[model samples]
Target: MSKPLNIIFAGTPDFAAQHLQALINSHHNIVAVYCPPDKPAGRGKKLTACATKQLALANNLVVEQPVNFKATEDQETLANYNADVMVVVAYGLLLPEVILNAPKLGCINVHGSLLPKWRGAAPIQRSLEAGDGQTGVTIMQMDKGLDTGDMILKATCDITPSDTSASLYEKLAALGPEALIDTLSLMATGEHTAEKQDDSLANYAAKLDKAEAELDWSLSANVLDRKVRAYIPWPVAQFTFIDEKQNPQRIRIWQATPLQLAHGKAPGTILTADKKGIVVATGDGALSLTSLQIPGKKPLSVADILNARGHWFTPNTPITGQINE
Candidate 1:
């Protein structure tokens, strides 16, 4: 059995919380947890604790919410922990060299991608958008450059045709803890090896933007279908259209599928509107919008939406939006 080591955990959000929870259940000692400070959220704009902070506090562990590692005092406090190692997962803040070197074994991170592929802020979503066959958790030895770390361990999971960002997030989150614990065990036993990442194959996953969620009818149905899956639970796939009253309104498409229509029509034209779905023409194929929502309303299936507002989306009506290449 591997001996327990003093560990400092740093992360934010639900993805990070799963890793922290696994550490708490392990035999190792979680000396402290570092998370982002509470930020205003929701309609009331009240300050809310991050998932990591909430889990740490519930387990009676020390929690630190430092904005960054630039301060001398903060550096001193972190060094005082005398942690054998620091484990980071989805921790939004960048670690300074001083803090990284302070830990006995240096800092390590549990990243959501396979490294050298999707290495930036939104790897999960980027992988879906790019139609990658698979993605996984990577345990890396932290370095100064962004995700340009030595790989310690990895565990892959497939990106299925039916996978949305939300579904893929859950799978990666569960895979992370198992991979992390195994890496820690290897490090403890001095059996872990570091593999350098190839910079030539690296690709940056730029953070998602609301602008990217706007559906462009000019794109192929397959591409737009992937975008809808990629942007779920964030800036969902959306399109703007002038309603029956000639008022411009935006609708978010929650679920959709691509289809090769027998007869072609102009892109953005509504081909069919029935109980099954609202089939719209695309540049190369057609898309069946199964679930959708208007502003300030709950999501509804195409059948329910047709029953409520069939007149708004009559056949031949065109959905307008800015087209991007």
Candidate 2:
């Protein structure tokens, strides 16, 4: 049998936590875990541990939450672990050259998108927002540059028509652990091949902005639809409309679909409204909103929303880009 590797697992979010869990289940010796320091979260601003740190603690593994790797002591502490390899997934911190080269087998990362494409902070969301047909996980040999690394392995998945960022994240998170484990095993056996990334084919996925959630009706319905899907479970796609009292109300769109409406109308004008959905005209076509929510209210399907506040979403009302006082 191949010898178990001494692994130092580093990650922060749920996506990273899943990979850590998979490593723990394997026969590899996890020497230590590194995660971001606890940050203030929720209403009371209580300090909250990252998903990876929580998992590592639950499993009784050594956990370290270093804010940065610039400190000499931190560097020495990590080196002391004497890990054969380091596995990083969504760790959200920059690793200096000293830390990167400290491990015997060097550091590797489980990135969310197919390498050479969508290589940045928000790859998953950017892929969905751009209407890409497919995306997957890439096990990359880490380099100093941002996601600029040699790909050791990759596993692709189709982006379905109904997929949202949240859904695709779950899918990729599930796929990551298997690919990571296989890559690590191959590395241990000296069977893994590293493919240099093509610079010409690379794309950067810039971090998502809350401002982008504001729906611009001037855009094509197809574009709007993709944006809605991309922003799910984060800064949700939103639009503002004037209520009966002339007050502006903002509504968050949870679910929507692009449509091919025959009639030419002003974009943002409500074409139809019923229990099933609200169809609004757009620059190219129309968008049918299946689910939406107002501030302080849980998301509800159009049918349920209409049952309580049907008057709020009147047909012929125009959704605006910005709320007017």
Candidate 3:
């Protein structure tokens, strides 16, 4: 009978939890699981546990949530796990060398990009925003450099024109566990080889933030369309019309499609509103917003919103949305 490989898992968020679930389902001997400490979130600032921590506890595996594991002595505890292998997903904290070298097979990571591109903190969001043709997961042997690890396995997925961060995230999250399982199976059978990432071709997927989520009217309609999709579920794109004629209402756009207009109206212009949706003019074309959420209101289809609040917006007027200082 084949012996179960003793493993240490590190991760946070729903993405990481998926992999942990995979390991448990596979009958792998996970010695310990590491994740970020509980954080204060939401209006109450209540302390909430990370997704990984919740899973680790439920699975009866040992769990660790250190704020900063950069210290040499602090990392020694992980080295003591005597793990045969370490599998890391979107574990928020960076692992030091001591912990990396703890396992016999070193460590492996499930990164969310094809690699040599979008290789850092926010790969999924950046890929969609850049309008990339394809993106997927790269299971790599963890190295000191950030996501510059050598690839042991890779699987690609198409990025549809309508793909949003939320949709792509779930797709990639499902892939992580499946890809990790594939990598582990090959590694167990001595059929895996690591391919080094090209240093010069890499692009950093810088962390997502509210600052970048503000829709810029000056940019071409195609660009803003991607921005609206990429920023979904986090720092949603917001625009406020300055015209008193319009309600200075804030709306969170959830999805959009680009269209070329024969008439080039100024960007941010309220081109029209109909049963289909609200069409707004842009630098090069226009965007039809299908779904959106008004401030302090539930998200609704554009048609429902226009029918209820038709007076706030008029056809062929500048939207007047501004990023408030």
Q: List clash counts for every candidate, in order.
A: 0, 0, 2
| lDDT tens per residue, model 2, 1-325 | 5678999999999999999999999999999999998999999999999999999999999999888999999999999999999999999999999999999989999999998999999999999999999999999999999999999999999998889999999999999999999998998898889999999999999999999999988799999999999999888999876667767678899999899776588888888889778998899999999999976799999998889878776777665523334
Better of 2 and 3 by TM-score: 2
Task: Give the per-residue Cα lDDT of candidate 2 at 176.
Answer: 97
Point out where model 2 deviates above 4 Å. Answer: 321-325
Cα RMSD for candidate 1?
Answer: 2.0
What are the lDDT figures for the candidates, one per model?
0.92, 0.91, 0.84
Q: List the candidates' TM-scores in order.
A: 0.97, 0.96, 0.93
Q: Candidate 3's residue-wise lDDT over 113-171, tens digit each?
A: 99979988999999999999899999999988899989999989999988889999999
Tell me the spans in candidate 1 whose CA falls farther than 4 Å from its real position. 321-325
The alpha-carbon lDDT assigned to residue 167 of candidate 2 equals: 100
Model 2 steric clash pairs: none
The local distance difference test score of model 3 is 0.84
